[model samples]
Target: MHKSDYIVKYLANSTSDYVTSAQLGDFLSSSTRTVLRYIREIQAESNEHGFEIISNKGQGYRLIIRDKAAFQNYLSNSLAEHEKSDLNKLECQIARQLLLTDYIKLDDLAQQFNYSRSSISRITSAVASIFEGYNLELESKAHQGFSVQGSEINIRHCINNLIFNSFTMYQTARMLQVDDLDWNSFKKAATDIVKSRGLNFKQELLIQFMKYCYIAVNRIRNKRYVNFEQIKDLEFDIVSDESLTLMLELIQLICPEFEKTTESQWELYYLALAWEQSIYPVEKLHDPNPERIKFFLDIVEKAVENIKNYYGIDFTKDHQFLKDLAEHISICYWKYLLNVESENLYLDEVRSKYPTAYYYSVEIAACINESTKTKIPDDELSLITLHFAAKIERENRKQIKTIILCSTEFGITELLKSRLNKQYGDIDVIGICTCDNKVQLCHDNADFYISADQIEQSELNGKPILQLSPFLDEEDCHLLDEFIARLNTTVPLQSICEPNHFYILNKPAKKAHLLNYLCDYLLQEGRITEKEKADIFAREALVPTAIAPHVAMPHCIIQGSSFLVFAVLPKSIIWDQTRINLIILGCFHEGDNQIKNLLKQLYTVISNKQQVDKIIGCKSYDEFIKVMNDFVGEELC
Candidate 1:
């Protein structure tokens, strides 16, 4: 469950005074707006329950239980009966069955799940696409059933993945159509195996291993054993004594059919490698091949180096990063060789929430793909993106160095500095100067200049100057904040987006019409040539750059001065499957570093739904600027 649901349950069981959103937010370490959103969701959920949330304007919010018995009963049955028949669950079930058994018929699935053959067929079609990611295919024979055709290792990956996903063997077995199993015997065998080897594995992996052993035994009993001869060309070295005895005992106790063949040794080696990577810690691995280990480490270090050079994030010295990536890549390389697809849970969330990092990860994945000559799946790419996102989020709290230039009377500069410090704790005001300060001192290692008096571009030796009022009111503070937003970065978004560049379109139009309209505007303004406009469409054809849900940032590096052209279509226009109301077409030259930064910043802004809401509500360019300013202030601060 999400924290929002936890907060709702807490509120429902509150014993104190009415809880304010502020108190709830503070308790949860979240924003009050987020708390209110959770409360609103809880209120919606209460529509079917016996609990209702009542908000008292001044006092705060109170959870009023209409019927205590009914509310308790609702909570009791919520977990077990919550959405039992979703398409995603059905897909998982079908995939689980395919991974467990050699062949499954549609009629058998239809009878088992109480669904029509057509419905099962549609589900199997989706499952086929998923299997295709692992380089596996669903094949149908003339008089036989359907089977997932793949290498032995890939099939094992699919089976273990299914077991790893569901919490218990009982739940997974139900999905796999395994009935009347001896649970006591399975558990005892797993316990005995772990005890004999003295291996400390997580309870989940213990259950998963038991399930794997059971499935392997059952498949062998049905004369459907996996063929290990296909991978005979590949060499492997086992590095654990525990793995040797464990595999021997498991095969002797469960699948005694192949105890004397090379298949048993291959299965033992691969299973031991899997255990060391997945269940066991990296440090526990006994003397692996040094060259193979260094190869994986080199890939990680080079990827981090490329990320630092490309996006300016120095995760090279981050030891935890090196360890995490090294360990993941070790398993990743094995999966790549075996053509096993990882089932990433946070794929969509990471893609939407941290798209900049996701994009950077794709670039990094491309480098790995070229170097290794292996196709990395999108799920694996998302996992890599998560590490980058975490590193960026960790470094986001660093101070932004600034030099404040104020020409006001005595103590006024100090007061403005204090206010600035309070408003933005992330800003480090290294020096406060008057208008008559030395030019070299103003440029002394500071990122940017914020001055009360208007400074010329040449005054600070090419440093960007943010002109602000002496008193530093809200508008002045926001104006000064634009510099802080891009202080550490190469681009200032306000510099790219001018007041003349914004256009609000209330009329309905297609993407082509909108693009042509913007291109015509640029042509009339002499911002781009006709060929550059055509190049925009050419770039769009290559990849529809809908960076967010309702935002599309389509850009091309053509022969022109950089221009950030924005079109706010509040009524919405169709782009792919998403409804885009904000279109930012960036026209830049062949080499413009700030344009990339501007695109990244725009992605950051549009990733936030609240910021998009504020942007869509804007009726004028000034309000749009304010929204941008507010977003920068909130985010940077």
Candidate 2:
């Protein structure tokens, strides 16, 4: 069934109350725009049938069936399959062919797919950027047809990803049905190794190995072997000759029919490198590439130091965690340097479910990016976050590590620390750091920072500053109590924006026109693309963006830099039966860990009638920024 089938079935079953677009979008995991568009399409098609979707202002949508038999028949026909996407057969065939062939003429693609040249061209454009995240380009030559351009290893990685995204490694092997190859033995070799190993290999890593082996086997059959002569000459060592021999043994056991050529031996070494990167711990010292491990470990140490400086969490003493994290980064960072792109399927779930660890990972990623001058994919970022999340959960500290930045005068800081120690068992006061000795703070392993003296907020980093009198007055004690009470509230990750990115609109316009106009700036800035913009609108159709009266939040998954664009529409245009005066356009890169926190802060502001009114009253970007800072804290844009 098509995506629109979801809306139709949903509306058909809603008999009691009006279903809101937001409700439908949430159920479908879609945007308001997509839901609305689906509803329109479903309704237009249902008009020919016996049912029609009724859309009301306050009440969401309801199904009014004119002919029960006809509507039931229609539902039966559509609901036979579950979550079966209505993909274009022509497009699928063309996409698969394009990935396989080195180059193919547009007309040839059209003939092969049994479609017009224009139709084939359009379909190709859709999947054109499939390899872009892999640091490869799909260049379309005007006369010579389309071909991929990049490092060969990266190309293979991207191709395998594209194939495995739709089909599994074993399934693709079955479908390909290459002649005279014992595919089952190859599969058995992987299963046997995993069985001999342990349960540690159960979590999709086996499938990754299977995928890599299958791709390598298939490519080698076509006489395309990885050229690794120059790669071994490089300083970065990946695996030992023993590991390569083990891989070659497996290969020989599986495909004894193939020739024992020098090229096949090199392929064995290449495959062995994959195994080393997969991280199998040896009984003693197993890392063949100590230089690689040391390099990434140094980077990880730098990241840990930065994390301490920024978030005030010190992991330097955690030698075991440091080693594990560095080894993982060696694999992740090496893949990056090799121009390989991969998907971490666990990224979104980790970001949403494990917010704290994910943020910690983000900080580490920031340090890595700064240290190397590279933008790692969100997928890799997710992998790093996964590691940290696992480590943090394993550590499982009971108390919140906190530090006090109070005056040394009269030892009042000592008094405050004593009081905290006596009253709050959950809050651990590690030490005190004065402004002059604040350099010692990074080593304290304190994430929650508090100040007693009235120091300038600008002097310290953008750490959460709760200023109190050093004298420890009654009001000061009360403030401390309140701050301690709200310690469980998470510090939100916010979108940073320049003052110019914020706009004050003097004239009101329709939502469509306004969204386009606002997103156009992002497009020009290379923050978003036309395809991503379409996704935003589709999301809007699924769920109305307007959160409250005169306020709406429209956002989309963007490329490159993530940003939030704010607009104050003083004229107040009608949206979803209410006039919308405030628009917060959140353009985020996929797998951003901050989206949940950002929405929480934004909804807090929108739900308040007084705050909405105050924002509507603003006449300029400066005024809007001030109001936002007041409502959502100074960090939010």
Candidate 3:
């Protein structure tokens, strides 16, 4: 979200409380100083947007809505733009241009897009990551603009994935606007050929093969072809004579230049590989490559073992789950080899519905990448999460729906909700209800009530309330454990890492040395095995977790209960090409069986850089906990 929009939304949700710069900074995950600057910028134009930010003397700042409709409209538009930005429209436009030709002159693109030369330059850089995964590089030339240089095989695979898989064939064709091709005729001929040849083509990917066949025809006509030398490492049994003959016939439909000759062998292999991949089992004539399957299966098995070692959950016992995971991993590996990607239509749904499974899939992705040196795209990860989601659903645990009854104090209600949600993921905090909405919102919504005061008989509605302080005490917390039906203890940070795991590094240290200290300590205590320690380092090697400004969170899942080992450097340290002042080594012990509460616990602390700075400022354990207690922040009864 835009800085101003986030600040405004946070203040709007804050109710009557006047949020301080400290609180706003924490909410924005920025330093209080940065928040103050943001507040100045927002306030400068606040009146125009129909809201007034009232800065009170002792209390922080409160948003006063002068025009509700206008404010809501502005907020909605800002968030809509934010959500669309991870992959923006203009970036996609430029990517399509790259697919159409070898190079695009920035000067020409600037005139065509009606954007400034600098804007066009910035956009092409943004779209570079899309091709990076396919091992393609965008090289700028003095006069030629920029050229996308890569293997022809990778180029074809990248084009097929982007055009067809990401969008509908109809939408893709319009986006590309390739002038002379007949979409309907091409589709018909391709479908007819597949039907006549009796190839078991995947319905979703059949069109992709056809599109690639079109690329092959165009490229060969331009005197470009896949030479044998480029594919020296290609390994796969040849398709049956019948399949090769069919492949030849399929290519000859449009390009008679393609021939059954020694020179054309590799070109034929290129088309056959694309065709076989489009086929459901890869090849009907040969069993799926046993070595390739085993290679990925080994990595999956090891990752599964790592999960068991770390989270204490065993997927090995569930034969079907392992089998399913292995099969999906094999398919994903196949896509990786071919530089192709598939769309996960249910990615967002899977993330919201089975968040825990989605996180587990993240670990699996990292493990696979470390072993195989390949990135597993989110779409593929979501599919893997479904496999984990199946196991998650089988457990069939009931979630405890909760409603927090508290006053609209500056930070009281927020503190309570964060505590409850982080303590147990299944304990859903439906919403915080005040004296006004308590009777109405609580009646049908809450399974139980967490209140700071006794409920009057008239407002009781026969529901039990756990009367407790805003800062939850041990006895009331124990009662909560029993009330919520969870057997796990509510482990506070003090109990987990306050005294021993916490560190204030006085001397300068490299990122590697620093992490080694944390891992070595865990290893010495036998809290984490040597292999698990190696897993953490291996993960860091594959992907750097550093963010710009001043924050770095190097985290991993582990066996036993979750705990954190935190450290603060006296000065800035260069970590994986970024400088950071604070480091949080989060060892999450998610059982993965129940809803994951630990993730909720860590998210509030690490969600922003300013939050990390605030954490680093605390010199003592008591101050740290006190500051964090408020970070979950606010409520009362």
Candidate 4:
């Protein structure tokens, strides 16, 4: 059954009222025309069930069902049939094979599967499109036949996606008939290996490593091995003899038959790669190579400079911050050289929740990538962001101004204030206003109000009021912490941008030319120095600031003054490597964490494809600003 059939059944069964095509399209992340096409298909499929889609022209669509039980039954049977289809299984198999193997002959595949050459060709063609998204190509040579052409790293990325995404890891392993003992043996060996190396493997990382090892073991057992000689030797540090001994022990421990395996080095290197990506505890900062340490420090040094320049937050003085960030960068560099992939569960959440910290990490990531010439994966990028997020959280702790509104009866107010200071080290208690004289409370610098009495909602005076027990229990502490986080809301993006900062460009230009043009305008307007323009290009070279498909926020840190520059090309202008219709250049001063939330808002506004389309179509600068203001202004902190 088509996906649209399921959607149609859902709509028809759930609603008696008219469901608009736009609503369906939005839910499916599809278009109205596509929804209509699906509706038509559903109508044809629903012939037996007497299902119909009635259109109400301007208002939208309604699902009309006759004999509801019959429709539900048809939907269930069709879905079951779709799931069990041989074609779906074959597609998964072909994709898995393409990802793991070097080359496959169409005729040989046809003969093996007992299918026609034409059928195999069609399957291979369909799988090729999937590989293309990862910058890989399916090419057929005269003698070699069909193979996925890309860098080994990219090929692994494609394979990882195929394995985890196309089917569950357990299911894929089951399909290969991999023994359960092999996985258990792999985990036991992994535990021993990490224990010996003083490294820790979180559950998420362990799962990924196990999957990779399973795939490698299956491939090796089938005589399909990655040739170590063909693999390029990367220059960096290598594991110690003790670690190598542990790896050899790990390989031998997987199975008694593993000792007879011809490709032992490949397996050893796989372990090495895993070890390189594993999280190293701060206590295990033992690098024998001083030069490598210096190399990483130099990268860190530059990153600190860029962060200080761009966001105005100087991390150099934060000793713990420097230590944590340095360790992360070192591992990141090693991972890059060895083509190791790191997984972080918090990547998406960090990107959304801590956009400011994530922004700095992006800057740091770009700098590292520029110097090292390797792309940082999103998970790894988020790991880097975590360090900055921690630092920012520390800074924010000092910035939060709290007020306690407790009466001086039995000296419980003083006791509560001291507990507040002890329980929440981040908050700053500015005043201790009595509950009876709530009107005397300070509202100007206060971020949160804590009271022992039942303060009415109206008495909050727009401030967040946390009602607490006089003794300060666990629940009250939790509530206070939650309220304190709300203090992060700062000045809006529109307030940050002035009339002169907005620009509308008509001429077509490439990314570099346009960047230079924008910088030239900034320089002429005396908003930025020539040196700052060079810094923007330098930052751009490290990472294209295109945060979304249509919007790119290219920015740099400059001395003295900061400017929020917004530009709309309306025409497709090359941004970084992609084409962008809008660019917001954030020229920031030192110690500026305020822009972090603004970037978050900018991303939220840009992520809406419909809103972006409307903004891009604006004819005048005033119209464009109005659209941007309406979108970002109301939501700004």
Candidate 5:
């Protein structure tokens, strides 16, 4: 894998986790300074997506991706733009050379590219600088040669940064280099570490091992040489202070078998460090309840199948490191589910043992069951209407002091004020005022103002202004109650006894036809006229009533209509290429107070999938009606 690819994978996996600089340095056998550089590059690349690589005083570095899709989109756009930049063209060639080779020597790269050693150094330095800024260190060990060190997360960040910043021509040309990176070598090393450590290994340790191998191989491919003094300074405490002597001994043992060059010495040191880091206590898998284990096993099997189907990446191969990872995860999951005592049950431990596996496991659990399931009340309309009245009344009560304004100075203002006070006795009118003059003192003291005429002169912005002209009639109060009901009430149950009642459809394929059919049904049933349907259509055009996926509830109140009507469509249909399967067509008659209760109940029933599916699956209309009656209850007519 390319250095950048390894970095991207690391950061993408370590959500809300910290990675220390020393840990990164040891993994890559590089200096902490170099790791810092890579982090800066990553931060710059992820800048637009709010990709922040935060560094705490004591902690090392972390990749915070607020918007995943936005970041990906930004990268795509950046890549397109980078292709046309001169700086990007040069960087591509540098990356290409680093990728294509097995072990790159700075001198060799300069010779091949016909650039001076100094020029090659500058290019490598520029690339290395990118890693440094992101808290990623690019270091070279005496035996390991060179490697990128830092937070694995930041390393992943560097890859994305590089990919997005690099030229398109370089991307296509770099394919050969990508192939030569020997991703299998790192995978093998990771698998071996897991096997040697047993199921007890922390997921983070496995991740660290994989990252180490990835960086080592890339360094060799890049032919980026690290000086011996730099390798000696690496702070690796995995091997005790005395064990450092053992590492030297091990390196000596391995070095003679290879070409014994300076590069070979470095490679041996890297191998020795890998061996030391691989040592850990093996965890024995506890025999969990067979039934519980099987349940988790089935889930894992299905997940594996889905992964194969969706991504086409087979994990069944012998060399597949993630295969063992999957097995370990299943064991942990079984232990967690059955409440069995196990050493590897904690999420942190699971993360350390199988980072990727832990992530997928959580996703599976979330998909199986949501965190919350709140059911709305059955008498939705009445409940909602009550809730609306309570809310509005509460707000109105909060407006204690008010000034009544009138354009025509008659007893009309006092008469309306008396009625308002009778209904809402808490309201205190400071005095009667006129819109013809500015009353600054009253404006400051009063919470709201009652007016009869249009008053454009107002210094107060959010202060309540009640217009009495529009609200004088009894019909207007009913309208206010209905509007309040819609806001306050939960969705109501469909009144199955009402022939012209509306039902919300949940299926996507049948939504459009259902809507059209309901429109025609209302007209034919004499519940609505063509002109009213046209009016409803115009309202729908202004603001669609389709609230959720596969469901649309359309309604409009017209004058002189007596009873409400409903039409139900269960199957989904396409509307503007968007499938809406469920629809509830409600036609409310003038002065109908029960519409709120009906709507509330319908919303409650529709919200419950079990209830909705049961209603939709009925073989006969009577069976469907029976299910509706049972759900809404026979007590509610």
Candidate 6:
């Protein structure tokens, strides 16, 4: 390992406030003169990179890189060339470990690798060389050992650089072997590089380069390559020649390092890129205006061409596909800007075929959203409404069916009704009664009443009523509109379980266990299967199945899963260290449009804590089921 790399590692591992030169010399097991020489070299490099290296004379050095863009530029320039091959290998090892973890200790690392402390110290010095320009200091204090001293941003950059360089080194390690290499030593070396340099900048650059390689290689790897013409209509800029050359060099260098596991590593890298892109789209260079869109499409087309030239992946030049991809990319861009979910069926499908392109597309979209002020379209608003409705319906089903008691006159009531209808057209209005005759018209049937005037009766005989007059003055309509505008608009397809099939579980014990038990029972009865279980598990992983404290509803959309199974756990059990006492397992077959309604009914029963408590106290399974069926109605299942 390079001496500079070793110094960097040692400093990063040491989290002390300061490390004296004497201590650093001791840590390196070298003379004070040799340690001073290494420090001077690091300082020189730091100066060249436009960052200051603080020397406390007796106390050791610190690096500080304040400007992120400048730091990134410094990192890019630093890693642009691989000067010392052996140092690079050590650097790669250190980088990989840093990416995986936050910090490392020098002594622990030395012991793990069966190396002398001095050897680890040497590696740390070498790693520190890469972080020269970032105004960072490597400090070591009694008990603390060594650490990097600089701006948090600079420290992050150093870590990223270490990882990027380490990745490069890992790929090229086998070709150039230095004896006495171990995982601990390698990891320590990498960690040092990250501490001295920066990890975030390096990682971003590496990702960019890897994406370039992935696109190029995939095109040629497969038999059916996408034709450039097919993707010509899509827009995105091809990376510059200089950038491509750098990527090519990196690939060639690293290819030999992981020769045996090249394919797997490549696959993993691609998967990571795909996942990240699906979640967060790339930031585009230009805004999402018409001209900018055209420019983006051109860039994409150019990228597609480059992919064809480098790799043999066949890209369709279909205008519609490109257009759609661009639109999806745009959506992804906005989603990232809005901090929302971007990857769905569209991006997922694209990833299956053109993973690289899909990532680029999403990233471009994200950039567009960030750069431009795109107005939310009517369709987007509608989509948001549906998403909002889904959440509302999920949280409070009683609110789904409301009675709007307004005066029969066309002034306020008609205006209010029109506004309500516009916002919640999907909401079921059982009856729209005039204010004067609201008491006479269907008292027992209404779910809730929204009225302008306050009723004197206590809860209207225990029925829930929302008095909007106090909250909704003239100015409140605008506020309400704004709130509604912010609502999620994605519409979910109607579900399959009927209202009668819905069952509520109110008990708090063994929530997940009881759900699983009921699912197992249903499976035994030929109501569900392994596939259904798998599907349910997948959804649960994305978001917790526990909708409320001490409660969980595990359900799946599967064929032959028709009945809603309700299981009550009388005593709570520790699930994932949380007390869960209630489990509601709703199983549904394909083509069940009433599933949404069932969910609504279940939501209503659970939302009422009093009702839930009463239900939980029931002794027999039959009695429990009876209460659920009574709430949901018996005929619909």
In model 5, the runs with Cα more than 4 Å from the true position are 1-513, 560-570, 575-578, 635-637
> What lDDT does the true structure give each of the candidates?
0.64, 0.64, 0.65, 0.65, 0.47, 0.44
Taking the tens digit of each residue's C-alpha lDDT, what string does model 3 give over 559-633? 766667778776887664345787777676655432255443454345434567787788976677776656543
Between candidates 1 and 2, the TM-score winner: 1
Candidate 5 residue 216 C-alpha distance from true site, Å: 50
User: TM-score of every model?
Assistant: 0.51, 0.47, 0.49, 0.50, 0.26, 0.37
Model 2 — TM-score against the truth? Answer: 0.47
lDDT of 4 by residue, 1-637 (tens): 5447657765866554777765675454333434554665565456677677666756666676787788778777777767534575576578677665667788888887788999988887656655554546788988777888865555655565556544566786775446654667678767776677666658767776666666666655656554444233334544545655665666566644565345666566655566545545434535545555566666777888877766666787776667567766774564654444353434445665576887778777776666666666545677888888878776765557767776565376678788878776667788787756645663347876777777665346577777788788877765554344334545644566777777788887766677888889888988889898987887665443666556888777677555677777878864433457987788877566666555666666665667788777877767866786565443254
Local error of candidate 4 at residue 95 (angstroms): 3.3
Poorest lDDT segment (10 consecutive residues) of candidate 6: 223-232
- Candidate order by TM-score, highest to lowest? 1, 4, 3, 2, 6, 5
- Report the Cα lDDT for candidate 2: 0.64
Better candidate number, 1 or 4, judged by lDDT? 4
* Global CA lDDT computed for model 4: 0.65
Q: Which stretches of candidate 6 lie above 4 Å from their native place?
A: 1-257, 260-281, 285-516, 529-544, 547-550, 558-561, 569-580, 604-637
Writing each residue's lDDT as its tens digit, candidate 6 over 86-129 gives 55566546533432333467786577656678887887665554
lDDT string, candidate 2, 502-578, tens digits: 88888757667898898788779777889998878765643345544567777665656667777888788755434
lDDT for model 3, on a 0 to 1 scale? 0.65
Error of 5 at 588 (Å): 0.6
Estimate, for each residue in 23-136, the C-alpha lDDT of model 5 and write its tens digit: 554444333433453554465456666567777757767777788887576556555653345443465456544433334677766887778888877777655554544445
